[model samples]
Each structure stands twice: as structure tokens, then as C-alpha cells.
Target: MSSSNSVEGSYSKRCAACKHLRRRCAEDCVLAPYFPATHPERFECVHKIFGAGNVARMLKAIPVQERAQAADSLSAEAYWRVQDPVYGSTGIVIQTNQEISSTQCELAKIRAQISMYEAQMATEQQPPPPGLPQQQGSLGSQENMPMFEPNDPFNFLN
Candidate 1:
């Protein structure tokens, strides 16, 4: 029916940005693809952090093919800015870097432990020196174990 067609036509014509701006969304509107009418909050957040004019100018400045990625980046930055007014995304980056470093250090330590165990096993399997008499129950005793320094620095790259 004509009524249903008109409703669909009206709904598809306005994007979130244009609707928020109280203007019609032209067919060539750059913001339309990124900010559809269904998710007005995305456009609102981006608008609040980076003004509508700035967003429009930035989108226009970039290549059309890269606009979607730019929009996502802008939205994420806006979200971070809202969550952390002072540091924003920088705080998140620093925290993530610290966590990665901690995990790398832990992995290095475990690898070192595994290496030590393998060395011990290899030594245990080898026959004693030709002239030396083997002591009973002393082959794998704790007293003869080599001391491993807990404070040894382990480089993940090495």
C-alpha cells in the first residue's frame, strides 16, 4: 500500500546525525553510513566528544574507503573520554602494556623452570663418572640439587 511505502521511505531518509541535528539526511550524507537511525547514541556520544562539525570535516578529509574504521575509532575514543575524562584512551593503553609486560615476565619464569627441570632430568639419566662410586639414594636427593636464583632476570626475547 502507499501508506506503508511512505513510512519506509520516511524512516530510511534520516540518519542518526541528521535526526539529532534536526535536518534532512541527503542521499550523499557522509555520516549516514556510519551513524544509522537505529543507533542514535553512537552519533550523540561522538558529537559530544568531537563536535558534529569537526566529525563531518574529519570524515570528509579522509578517504571514503577508510571512513568506517575512522568512525569506529572516533566512537571508541569518545567512549574512553567519557569513562576517563583526564587520561582517556592513554590510560587504557598504559594499563594494557603493563599487563602484557607482567605476563611476559611470568612466561619467561615458567620457561626457565621447565629448562631447569629438563637439565636435571638429563643429568640424572647420565651414568656417573667412570672412576666415581655411585652413592645409594644420593642421585636425586634435595641436598645435592643446584640452587636456582629466584631474583635472576629473564629476558623474553632471548
Candidate 2:
């Protein structure tokens, strides 16, 4: 009917949820703003993972102000589910945490090695103990003794 067509034309062509559900999108559809028709796949993925009924129930159960955020979370979860069927986003998070821990351990080892090298260098540059004199020659050698003339006039014993 012309009136029906006009009424339908008055609203958006189709919201993502309506397209995924294969139904007409009403003007006041709650999901229209969050899931526009331009990105139907967003709703499709979410619907496939969390059934349409569950999504509707969840949206209805939460506060109206929080629905958009919830829809975003659902879409992200669905995408992760498709990417990693076994572990999803959780696996990626775990793997990232493990890498961070490993890097931290490696950094600690490098710091300890640097400290050891610094200690070794410091010891090498330090002067020896004060009281230990350097050995130049034997103590009993007469080569360094002062020579005395036997006929010196200044000799008091003569």
C-alpha cells in the first residue's frame, strides 16, 4: 500500500539488526543508531555468536544509556570468536602477557650483567694498597751503597 510504503520510506532503509534478522526496521528501532545498515556485518557477526534473542534480551535488560557500549563489546567479541575459534581474544591477551614477562626477565639479566662488568672495571682502575712498596732491586745488594775514599782528608777517624 502507498501508505505502508510511505511509512517505511520515512524510516531508514534498514538498520543492521533488521537486515540481519530479515525484518522491517521500525523508525524507533533501538539498534538503529548503534548498528546502521551500512555495516550489517557487525550485527550479523554478533547475532551469529550471541543469538538474536539473547542480544535483544541483553539490550532490554541494560540501561538505555549503556546499550551502545554493550553492542560494541558484543561486536568485538564476535570478531575475536571468528578469528580464534578455540581461545578468542583471551588467548591473545595471555600470549601478550607472557611476552611482557619474558622481556622483563631478559632486562633484569642484562642489568645484572652490566652491574658485574662495572664492578670489575672499578676494581681494575683502583690503585694498590698504600703500604706495599714496589720492588726495584734486592735489599742486600751493594750496588746502590754510597762509596767512601780511603785517603779522604775529611775522615774524622784518620
Candidate 3:
């Protein structure tokens, strides 16, 4: 049991960062908790992009409590850098923002249509006073209902 525990302890001690660098992992090693031995590939990708020293420095600079979040963010940035050498994560962020804006624009248009439909329905259901002529057509007399022009994001309203 003692021998098995020693072997397990030794194996667990070699974190991905230390293993990749061919160095022993110290108990106080900042990267040890974030980059464990199980995922060497994660360390390799981060090392390739940010270098081991830079990562160590970054981790050390951050507050102890926030180090885990910082490490995860670094990992994500490294992944994005590997995927897109030029634009990296910023390109994906911009694209996502544009998509959100487009969806919001579409939603606005749909809401405008719903409002128009509801107004039209309301006018048609109500009887025109006692002496007024019976209104004809889908929109009845357009004078009563307010016109709604859906704002187009792509084209300017003239």
C-alpha cells in the first residue's frame, strides 16, 4: 500500500506544464492546479502560443483566488490563437455581436408586424359610430390607424 501510494503521488506531482518542460512540479507551482498531468495537450497548445514562462508570470501576477479563472481564460485565448493565427478570438467576438444585432433587428420587425396586425383587427371589430358609412377593404379607413414603418438596419429610411 505504501509503495502504491508513492507511485500514485509521484505521478500526480508531475503536472502538464512541468512534464512538458521536463522539470519536477513543486507543490507551490502556479500552473500545477490548472494544468494537470492528464491533459498535456492543453499545456502544449498554451505553451506554443504564450510560452511557459509567460504563462507562469501571468498566473503569478493574478490574485491567488482568481488564478483559476485567469488560467482558463489564457487557455481559451491560446486555443483561439491556434485556430485563427491572425484574428484570433476577437474575430469570433465581432462575428457573434453582429449576429446578435441582426437577430434583434429581425425581432423588431416581427414585433412591428404584430402591432400592425393587432391594430387592424381592433379597427375591423369595432362598429363605426351610429351614422358613419360602413368601412371597406382590409385596412378600413387608414386615417384612424397609426402607420408603423419597421426600421431597416441595412437600408436607410427615406
Candidate 4:
């Protein structure tokens, strides 16, 4: 099991505990039947923990001083932390986020598609969000289209 190639290649296998837990999304991992589809990236499984950056984000959500204090208590305590139910439900896992890595990959693909869509939008003048009626003559129709700011790091085209 301890092979150099294991760390290098696109290994899709996950741990049994994660697989058996049957989670809906990694964010709801605190509860039974966890999944990894909560984040915009949907790469929760790829993270190989819970949600994409959920651990980091959860940790970050707390104040640094509180985290340090909790860390100390955690080390001193012989018992595990109190169990809190995951925000997600068991049905959620069954309905979606079934396969950890595959689901995660699918979620990634969805995000990529969304990003592509957003990028495509960035090329054109802003349009009404989908489902909304387009103005008879919107800015995109104007001839004097302002040049996009390339210097701006968020040019989006980049």
C-alpha cells in the first residue's frame, strides 16, 4: 500500500469509513452518511476530507484565539469531542453525492461549466441573468463598448 506511485497518480479510491458513512456532502459530514458536494468547487472528495476547504473554513470561521484554546483542551481531554449531527440528512446522501470521488469529479465538471459560462458572459457586456427579459436595447447592443480593464487582476478574461 505504501508505494510512491500512490501519491503521484490520479488514484480515485477513498477510505472505507468515508465510503461507508454515506454522506450527502462533506459539509454535512458531522452527521451520518456524509457526502462532498457542498462547495462551489464540488471537489470535496478530492480534498479527501469533507467539504472543499470546509475544515479550513470551519477552523477559520472560529476566532484564532478560541481555536488555540480549544486545541489545548482537545489535547488534554481523553474523551472525543461531543458529537454533533451533520446539517445534511441521510436522504440527501441517497439522493445525491452517492459516489465520493465520482460525485466530486462531476461536481467539479459542473463548476467548470459554470465558470466557462461566467467567462463567456464576461466577454460580452453584462446580460440579464437567465429567465429575466432582456431590455429592448441593452448596453451590450451599444457600439461604444468600454474596453475591459486588463490591468485589474479580476479582469475575469484572464
User: TM-score winner among the candidates?
Assistant: 2
Q: Count steric clashes of candidate 3.
A: 0
Better of 1 and 2 by lDDT: 1
Clash pairs (backbone) in predicted model 2: none
Q: Write the per-residue lDDT of candidate 2 for residues 26-80, one digit (tens) a residue.
A: 7677777778889988888888888877887888889999998998998999888
lDDT of 1 at 158: 32
In terms of lDDT, which candidate is strongest?
1
Count of clashes, each model: 0, 0, 0, 11
* Residues 1-158, model 3: lDDT tens digits: 99999877876689999999988788788899999989988898899999999999999998999999988998999999898999899989988999999999999999999999999999999977898776688779878986556775554554
Q: At residue 16, what lDDT does model 1 achieve?
A: 96
Q: Candidate 2 lDDT (Cα, whole model)?
A: 0.85
Where model 1 places Cα greater than 4 Å from the true spot, the runs are 1-8, 63-66, 135-158
TM-score for candidate 4: 0.19
Candidate 1: worst 10 consecutive residues by lDDT?
149-158
On the 0 to 100 scale, the lDDT of residue 95 in model 3 is 89
Query: RMSD to the native, candidate 2?
Result: 12.2
After the best TM-score superposition of candidate 1, give how far the Cα of residue 146 lies from its true spot, in angstroms. Answer: 31
Query: Candidates' lDDT values, in order?
Result: 0.90, 0.85, 0.90, 0.44
